[model samples]
Target chain A: MSEQQTVGFTVNGERHTVSVPTRELLVHTLRERLHLTGTHIGCDSSHCGACTVDLNGRSVKSCTVLTVQAQNAEVLTVEGLAGPDGLHPLQEGFREEHGLQCGFCTPGMLVRAYRFLQENPDPDEDQIRTGMAGNLCRCTGYQNIVKAIRYAAEKQTAGSV
Target chain B: MIPPSFAYRAPASLKEALALIDESGDDAKFLAGGHSLLPMMKFRVSEPAVLIDLGGVPELQGIREAGDRIHIGPMSTENEIIGSALLQQKCPLLPEVARWIADPQVRNRGTIGGDVAHGDPANDHPAVMLALEADFVLRSSQGERVVPANEFYFGTYFTAMEANEVLAEIRVPVLGPGTGYAYKKLKRKTGDFAIAAACVLLTLDRGICKRIAITLTNVGPTPLRASAAEQALTGKAIDDAAVENAAQLAMQICDPAEDLRGDKEYKTHMAGEMVRRAIRQALERAKEAK
Candidate 1:
């Protein structure tokens, strides 16, 4: 059993309220407390970006951030990326471009890429490599991951999904 | 895994935080973004009795331009430095180095002050700070004092910061016109720590070197200044041959010990390569001057 402290933050455009310990990681709060298990935890060491999320419009390793550090911050998890119609452009681009293999790292990759595109919407393959280098995929050797980002860039540019 | 149980305090002000740290004494640890401290805690390496969270201390965050110097708060995140137009335009070398720091997530939380405060030779920013001739503002209940980067780091993970002191800000003087800068690294993977890294900042007068600074990272017990290399190209036109020779001088400064990432001789050799590359990059940047 863990003692709880009052915590509040915006999760995916909705105000989600939860209580966690001062030591509770944002990753654990999302997975256990709020039940947003879609953001997988491959390595809690922040080496693997599998638990990446958007905090206050920036991509962060949730495993490294305590939920208390997230109080009053706007957060966007992988589960919120999809639209009412279906998958977001990045999701479609990943599906059409084959960005994953084992799929464990996809959610984190998508979230990281989602923020990357907003920052550098028209980055080339090389820039994509450098920008997305933080997110690791043990299954695929990054060739297809670069392709997915490129597809998203093109889709976002043309304004046609 | 959860971090070991510890009391926590999020002081709305730096004063309160420092007081808490002072009140708690040796058992307390300052938690910034937790990019460094948290990982160590998870691994059970350091289980401090209490965490004085610096997240609420607004005084410790942000990058500001002041009096020919860039005053970066100790809690200024790597992501903030990379995204700051002021730092980029004034000193492109910083964001250039910041980009290669870690992956994006760590950058978002891993802070410059934390990096400097940790004083790890493996940490890239301290070496760059040495080349930049940066000064650190340390605060405790007593008062504030500035420590030059060269004197701040005493050894591996050892700095001059006192137990009660908090790193408040970093002061960086702007490189005068005709100045050029570069940072180069060789990591097995893009996100991995550098086997060896080099930061070079210099000024040229009509193709003749006027000033120079060189620092190497992850090559010794402390991030080191390449004094021999700096001395080599003082009056000469810093060309490929000059860079090659200075890189050799940088190799002479490395005292790498064997570890998981690389062997001693290999790290020594790579230090030369990084210096060579960094010199070339700085040269490319130098061309932009009038």
Candidate 2:
């Protein structure tokens, strides 16, 4: 929707004032303008879930959201999951559990799983499956991703302890 | 997957959004949560010259229960509906339907208002709303009017909604005593669209149906109510024989088109089976409520 003016939003705690046409998707905005290529665009059609990100406080398919529509909204991409020289617990869990094979869908999966644990920290196997159903991973059977969430759960709880 | 270039305007109020739509005429489209419209826009399936964002319009969000009806604002997210205490207490059927909509992520962004106004027969809530005899409140620069759910949908991606109008709220009647409801869906995966779906709402008097409403989804250009099946169930005990007859009649009434999900025959048979299962579950739900 590039009709008249430019818009801006907060991404990964950074204020990004990018000039976008009124209809530019947030996924493209995060990838192209901001140079945060961590958010991949696999299937722009709300399917595939390759562009998953936390918008405001919830996980959402970035490809389906217009950049202008996200103006003044809080966006958390895959790049935002880490902090000074360390990985997020979900990232560590995926690495330790060998959750990636081809790694094409890893970013979205990681981000989605990150939010999944936040939404449901003590999720069971079935809960994890239902929670992350929107984010598909064809490369892996998700046996390990389920394990990864479990691993993160234990670590997160233990860390808090 | 960049959406084709279009001018964007985020309106501060319903009045402003409507005025923009009026000024831009047919070249403008309202973006409410943008779960459905933005995807279509990125695909170039719908390329409006201007995108009028409705997020700033404060009046278009929330759920309120008054008298015997539940009024849902146009911008209420599926998650919001699921979490709504008012709807959960009065119209539990809505939250049950909300739980299975798309996936958790899509549910966070997608609004029921957008879903109803989009008029996609394949979507779940339209059929659920129709089965509940929901009424849609439409507003424009002119004023506001209410259209019953059955009359709202016209055809594929079509509604009685005018180009300059916005759906203000959806009003659904709260079920009285002796009501039961169930929604049955068969999908390839958790997040995938439904292959076939069934929504049933029945009111029983001493274990015999006093009234029945059955609706089929993703099978036609509109959410179809199986009038013949409803007629068969009403004033009859919901026994095995009656359920079977009603299910079969509902299946017969449906002329499902062959899609990627299944052949027409398969969808038709599944529709019948879904009705049977939904009726059984709905009876149980009604029993629990009592």
Candidate 3:
């Protein structure tokens, strides 16, 4: 008999409270409880960044983080990447640059690149590759994904200017 | 993969956390960063009935300068260390090595204390700590005690850390003038565990090795210090012959397991290669320091 704990956290600007088992992972809480399926679980291990999410202003693998650990923390998933003003630049860039084939790794890639671009607003090609190394894309060979992130960086900077 | 059901406590203070550990006894584990423990729990390799979350403890959360040593809080993340101007100016080798540990996301979460207390030879920080001759401060409800990095590890996935004890701080001595360092790791891919890695810290006086410490990663049950290699280079001119002899001595200490990375022979050879590279780089940095 395991005890259940209640955790309250902000997700994509919304406050939500959920009672889950201590063993529940943040990825499961987002997908099963909050119904945010955008964060996928590729490798249960931390190797695959498919479950990467922005927790408390920094990107972390949600699968490796317990839901209880996220109490009072702010989380941003791929579902929150957009605004009231249509798709995010990353979403638009993916479409513009053909960043996905199967699209399994896109959400994680987009979310990670979201944080990556914020960390390094004007990243070079090598920086983009190194920053996105945590997220693995088996399809599309990562060339187009790199192009997509590059496109987003340019578009974001242009919009800011 | 779901971990076994366990009660989790996010204690507000280090005293409360240690009390929880004392109450739970060996069935409890302090969760720091969770990059290492969570993965093992997901694999069903480590099962603890209670998890003491040290994430909220403010006591174990920053790097500070005290006397001649830098006190690194247990909960300090890799990214924090990497971006820490204090550490970058004082202990650049750590931040340089932290960048090579994993990608950006992992660095944002993984902690140096977890890397050391976890006691995995494959983890980069252990060898770096051993090479730096760092000291780990372990605390329990009883009190606090400092353990040197070299005497800490007992075996693979093992350390001198007691069940009731928590890694409070990692106190690393400030590098004096003329010190040089480098961590050379060869992994299959980015974020992968090292196939064979070497961390070298040395001091050179007038182009002769005054002091040197060489440590190998993932080539043994624990991070092995190549004392013989250090001996071979100390007080000797770090020429090609001395470097080659030291690398060979480093190879003699390797007892690696064959995995997806490579076989024993290849890993041993790679260990020597990494040692050679680390020594050469450390020498160059030493000359630059001079």
- Taken in order, the candidates have interface RMSDs of 1.9, 2.1, 0.9
Each model's C-alpha lDDT?
A: 0.88, 0.86, 0.92
- The residue-level lDDT of candidate 3 at B268 comes to 100
| Candidate 1 lDDT by residue in tens digits, A7-92 | 88999999988877888999999998789998988877888899999999999989988888888999999999999988898999
lDDT, candidate 2, at A116: 86
Writing each residue's lDDT as its tens digit, candidate 1 over B95-142 gives 888888888778888888888889778988999989988999999988
Better of 2 and 3 by DockQ: 3
Task: Name the runs in model 3 displaced over 4 angstroms.
Answer: none
> Where does candidate 2 stray beyond 4 Å?
A1-4
**Which wins on lDDT, candidate 2 or candidate 3?**
3
- For candidate 1, what is the interface RMSD? 1.9
- Candidate 2 lDDT at B120 equals 83
TM-score of each: 0.94, 0.96, 0.98
lDDT of 3 by residue, B1-290 (tens): 99988889999999999889988877889999999899888888999999999999999999999988999997999999999998888889999999889888888889998998998889999999899889999999999999999999999988999989999999887887688899999988888999999999999888789999999999999999999999989999999999999999999999999998999999999999999999999999888887
Among these predictions, the greatest DockQ belongs to 3
Model 3 accuracy (lDDT, Cα): 0.92
Q: Clashing pairs in model 1?
A: none
Question: CAPRI verdict on model 1?
Answer: medium
Q: Candidate 2's residue-wise lDDT over A51-78, tens digit each? A: 9999888998988887767768899999
